[model samples]
Target: MNWPTAAGSDSRPDPDSEYWDERQETRPPGERRDEIIEKIGEQVRYAYDNSEFYREFYSDVDVDPRNITSFEEFEQLPILSSDDIKQEQKEHPPFGRFLCIDEEDIARIYGTSGTTGRPKVFGIGQDDWDRIGEWHAQILWSVGLRPDDRVIITSPFIQYLGSWGALAGVDHLGCTTFPFGAGMEGQTEQAVEWIADLQPDALYGTPSYALYLGETAEERGHDPAEDFDFKVMFFSGEPGASVPSTRRQIETMFDCEVVDQGSMAEMTPWMSNSGCRHLENGMHVWNDIVYTELLDPDTEESLEYGAEGVPTYTHLERTSQPMIRYWSGDITTWERHDETDCECGRTYPTLPKGIYGRADDMLVIRGKNIFPSQIEDQLHALDDYGDEFRIVVEREGALDSLQLVVEVADDAETGPDEFHDLVRQEIKSEVGVTPDVTVVKQGELDRTQFKADRVKDKRELAIDV
Candidate 1:
């Protein structure tokens, strides 16, 4: 697919394709590691010299940016957290001192999700914008997207990077993109009808919204698989599309291959579970652009391949807002396989098992740690409960209690008492905690057009009020 560029704009290289080939051709993981460290050293030195934020951060550390040799020495530098970004923006107002380029160079602006606090504003210069577009193109190609295909993107197009990145990638692919950006307005319905009338060959959005569209189509007696001619589904923003049961449900409803693409607002789109002929291993890391390290969540020590822990990332190509040894608050495991031949023989380093779960998403309830995925897995195992559910955590008499509110098929002929008992017993067996289970009426809970927030912690309300 031809990469997209504006009129008179210099033609940008297809870094995605180049990245895929370069990663596969690299000797061993150790050799790839050495190369990554060397490249990152150069970027770090540049950022330290040009960006004032990094200069002050490293001023007291006494390590010369030029002399910093190994990743271990790099780790000796203090970790940059989202709080640091927020504090910097708070002190400086508007854009912080991290900008290496002048204001005129910036082509786009975006903000963080602000799940923690006030959203931190970020700017992408013209060059960085082009780099982001190239990254998206690579992601699209990796997930089997083609230029001739028509795809509907249902993500919100505000200050968020995901929607724009997807649009740019589709444009790069030379695909006929139906920019059906988020919100279930008249336009969304129109977009669905447009999809039906136009019969886009692919779909993109959160898993929840995709399911909602499928339900809408079914209500109109139009099966998405039979009528829409959708061949592929690309999903992000949540773990649903990557989870086995959720992925199966979406694929079954849409009759397409469901692939998971992962990225953050701060970091460029770098990793994804694409169609590599094998497809069963983990997601492939774009090692050329971003270097990844798996660390023990508790000790913060680096782990070997196949070890499960939180993911730390270093952006190799980012010149605007450089992130070096940034902890990405997500939990995952990596597997290194030496399979040389496959249906698609591009040999980049693969994850084998996709992202396990988010480190921040895990909850410590009743002295036992549990993840939403654990609850999701148990719920999916039960045939009586519907896939839609939420986990509510609250303190009951000084003890933390979890409530599992699930939707079930109305025609199942099972009462709330029976369903409650089943969930309580099943959760006890699986999670070692007997959670209070409530069977909500089907369609009672609110549906989302974006990432579904399944876990809600209400513990703050019990602060002696």
Candidate 2:
């Protein structure tokens, strides 16, 4: 569906309005489907005419872009992966052929670290930038941010839009954007003092970073819930705010509600789904600007609404550069509302659980499908494990084994045997794999400034599967 255009810079929505996009957001699913089909045809025709890369790609695949009329037909369009874009950038050099806007029209450029290989850079034109701001503005609003609120962002701004994209939305929404970049020495300590001093209305960062900073503050005589004033805490980049125990712990420590925002790097970096602001835990998908589907990772077949699968998003209004069926790699599920399902009263598709985990991060050991997020949730359910953990997988006598080494936070006074049984039971219940649980002392796992990697596979590979 076509995203409603942003109002002029001088024009903004009413601060007290129930919704940012009142028209499109509350429409019934059947009503929007017709409009979505019309917009899909228009976007496809525009991309075929303006993008050199799409012209050749569609032709190579014997697909006529103009022939696509419905979302079902549009989904037949070829899917693109991160590696595919990297290769195109390598062959084209700098900005790839998919960039539809002229070089002079480019307003800003952001990119990924490209740890796998070549970096992927995306250009943002003036119009695209404005629309992106609108997308994120609505995201913040859905997560309980207000126009009069001030937010302190803790992600780096250089060569990254994860933080900058959100800050831009804050500007458009008339909020004071606090620049507090993390991933540096003592940044957490500095954030602690700033939160206590300024007492901002809202705080933003990854779940781990925010919780770590808040805990470090408590360790140094400052209680976040008492000293700091935070009405809401918005988080992205990782899973935790959505986990019940972790969410409860953070909300109690900060004395505020925790909201989860979902986004991907290749996408505009924000506004994939926004949390409900009116005391709701579901995440609402921005189906107006983007079309998405959930598919089984291995079979690449679309799944039912409630089944867990990989997400693939196609940008509808992205004019500077168009992304067609980009595999998001994040595992999630969604269900359309049956009228008043959300307390927010918006009809946007809701993700009851924000994110399960990454599809690529799944561990298939001994024919059992396990996800680290599931295990993390188990750890969160109990207090024996600390904030840090690691999963060690190894092969023994032609059989795979899992060893869950969890850090002892020292707060729980349970014995080792009881702790092991508790963790084993939790994992067996959640991940469906009964494994050996080892309770290690605190500080056994090194903590990073960003999302912590917890999985370690030490199994020797065989010549054949």
Off by over 4 Å in 2: 1-8, 60-63, 339-341, 460-465
The model with the greatest lDDT is 2
The C-alpha TM-scores of every prediction are 0.89, 0.93
Tens digit per residue, CA lDDT, model 1, 318-350: 667777777878877765645432345454556
Please state every model's RMSD to the true fold in angstroms.
4.0, 2.4
lDDT (C-alpha) at residue 74 in model 1: 79
lDDT of 2 by residue, 15-123 (tens): 7887777887788878877776776777777778888888877875544687676666776777788877888889897888888889899999889877657889988
lDDT value, residue 5 of candidate 2:
47
